[model samples]
Target: MKTIAIYGDSISTGTHGEGGYEAMLKSSLSLERVYNFAVGSSGLTRKTPVGMLEVLDKNPVPKDAELFLIWHGSNDWYWGSGMEEFSHGVKEAVDRLRAAAPTAELVWVTPIYRFECPDGMAQAGEAYELPNKNGYTMLDYYEELEHSSKRLGFPLIDMRRLCGIHRDNANLYLEDRVHPNRAGYQRIGAVLDREIQRFCIY
Candidate 1:
């Protein structure tokens, strides 16, 4: 793709300077622009101060962007954002994206698994399946994305289920069972790159 725009939370707002996924895309493809309008602590619900709604309203998407990736939901689950709210927000966000950039193809990405790593990334955390504040698990969040995307007729990249990172191998990629280290970012980026190519959208 000549240009790309992104919308999501911390995972999507990765350490680009330190070899984040966006950096890999920019360097590998010699992209013209990679507009990552993601912020830390962002989510899909209206309650999120810097969520998708805020990003689209405040950060303008490049008109020439060939593709747009929406990687969120993890933080939504963590914030206990209403499941119904997330579902409706997904459609609203898609409509907003089309209105903003009619030619930019949209793609949805699910959230990766996370855990409470008390000792850090030296090993995989045991409590990877615990529910969040609103009593929703990470799986609940990503699955909701899949359901919403399917109903809305959009291509979705199931990063949570497809990415190789898991409870056993999380320590190798994740720095704190949540954010990915440089190596982790690279691994996830590779999967993402392959998926985008497979869809022939970028």
Candidate 2:
């Protein structure tokens, strides 16, 4: 059995008893082990002194990992990190992962679509107070990551487009317009599993 390593945020860590998308993928793919190196409230860009990239460096993936899946950016957008900064963080993270897993295949999983939450947005905006706040959005982050993936020659899975989570299905899928519920996670896992099977040749 092959081992898969996941580097992500709270979405990879289970929410409300749901094992999140990574757990779902583990079960669906029937892999030997799935190492989830994700933390809640972590983003690619540093909102705090220690960010996801720093966390990853401290806790490296196993040497035997055959694949690496990188999923982040929700918190970056929420915290209002500029695209350029986000891109730089991503490049650094990818470089570190490549150095750690020289032979492993790397894939970038774009950030999922987050529904508009007026209260949540207002609170985050006030707390972060990022510059050029009006121009930042989840889609912008997604597009930038897509470009980065292409430039870096890494495969990408656009979860936002693939998952099809829209306003109508937000309640059923997402717990708080940002995190997905159990059913929503299952859907994401299904799509990821298919993508893995289709693209990853073990």
- RMSD to the hidden true structure, all candidates: 3.9, 3.6
lDDT (Cα, tens digit) per residue for candidate 2, span 105-199: 88888877665432234433211122225457776777788889888878888787899887678789888877888888878888898887777
Candidate 1 per-residue lDDT over residues 37-75, each given as its tens digit:
888878887767688987777777678888888888877
Q: How many clashing pairs does model 1 include?
A: 0
Model 1 worst lDDT run, 10 consecutive residues: 117-126
The Cα error of candidate 2 at residue 137, in Å, is 1.3
